[model samples]
Target: MDRLTPLSKPDPVVTLDEVKANLRITHSEEDVLLARLIASATASLDGRDGALGRALMPQRWRLERDQFCYGIEMPLPPLLSVQAVRYLDAAGIEWDLDLTDVVIVGTDPAVLRARTIWPTVLAEPGAVAIEFTAGYLQVPEPIRTAIIRSVGSLYVNREAAAGAAALDFSGLDPYRQWAFG
Candidate 1:
């Protein structure tokens, strides 16, 4: 089984001020609610649990696997860099693989290609781990628009039925990882 853990999360993609401006909100009475809504909007589209299957802001993640292979697929991309590749030795001791031994291939759904043979590891679950950063340093405009529109819909229909706030998310189709590969 493969497991992905967020080592650190990115700052909110859209700020409270930005959301407020989008909604034309001029009062501070709903600042707290708007802040929460901003977080909610970012969470709905930011990282692994996000619909896009990619990170919107730069963030760190650790991906673990049972064993090392010639190549490993890194999820949540727009991969920025790989910090380290590690494995648990047969004796249950953690060891870091040489950085020069591997290469990062592609951006979205980046692949880690081993330049040499993989090291031996214990026969156990999550014996190999790769720490890396993925996401955009500057988020695309369409994504920002989507988040703003989503927050607007959520704010406007807070009391109505679910379908009442129907949002046309056709603008976000291009960002979905599946759309690229």
Candidate 2:
């Protein structure tokens, strides 16, 4: 089974002040509420589980696999760096692959390539793991705008609505990932 886990949480891409300004909320009375909304908005569209299927802020991730194929595709785009690769031997001993033994290639769909033959891995589930950092050092302006708009929609419409309070995601179309079989 393939699994992806976040090693660290990404800080909110949209600040409380920014959300407040977008909502024209000047009072500190709702600062706490606004902060929560900002976090929710950002989480809804950030990282692997996000709608964008991408990381918005710089964050670390671990990808676990049963075996190393010819090359491993770093699913998250805008990959910043590959930190480490590790595998378990047949005897269940963990070994760290030397960073010099692998290289990162490409941009749109970053890939991890082994410079040498891959070390033997245990023939079992999750025997190999790769740790890397991915995401934007600076999130795109449109992404930030989308989050703000989502928060605004949620704030203004506390009650469920059929359409009047729907969150607008038109700004996110260009950034959203569409997978095809």
Candidate 3:
């Protein structure tokens, strides 16, 4: 896998229509794919790595920029989360916890776990503006518990994903009561 931060080319620019076509909305009943696509494309850079993955991953792709710091990442999963952490552990990362972003693998029966056993990011004031790719979430306590155990963290319950489009961003808080409410 290649580092995602440093790029031979810019992050893939996605269109509203493109994301819309492939969008499986979870929270809102309106079109919000463009926002997600934009966020994903932006987050795919290495510039954001210094602060995000500085201490977590030992050897990271390094770069300097005025607008944004860049770092190349080995493509792992939907997020730089638990899935990547698990892979990194096997690939020789010399760490027990990542404590970064939520590790989200896929949209299907997707797995979500906190990157760190005890999140340094979550404790910080403005670590990351959390977002769920598959959107809405409403899993059973058992499943949530399993995921929490995977990352040595806890679950932040969320609504379920939608079909047509999204009205707004959901899963922004630990409580899933009013993201799109």
Q: Which candidate should be chosen as best, given lDDT against the real structure? A: 1
RMSD of each: 2.2, 2.2, 17.2
How close to the true structure is residue 117 of candidate 1, measured as C-alpha lDDT?
A: 81
Q: Residue 145 deviation, candidate 2, in Å? A: 0.5
lDDT of each residue in 26-115, candidate 2, tens digit only: 889988877877777777778777778788888999999999887788866778998889999989999999999998898447878889
lDDT of model number 1: 0.84
Q: Is candidate 1 or candidate 3 better by lDDT?
A: 1
Ordered from best to worst lDDT, the candidate numbers read: 1, 2, 3
Q: Candidate 3's C-alpha lDDT? A: 0.28
Q: Which ten residues in a row have the lowest lDDT in candidate 2?
A: 158-167
Q: Report the C-alpha lDDT of model 3 over 74-164, residue by residue, as the tens digit.
A: 2221233222332212233333334254454453233445544422322222222222222112333332232222211111111325321
Pull out the clashing pairs in model 1. Answer: none
Once superposed on the true structure, which residue ranges of model 3 sit more than 4 Å away at CA? Answer: 1-12, 24-29, 41-181
Q: After superposition, how far is residue 35 of candidate 2 from its true place, in Å?
A: 1.4
Superposed by TM-score, candidate 3 places the C-alpha of residue 25 at a distance from the truth, in angstroms, of: 8.9
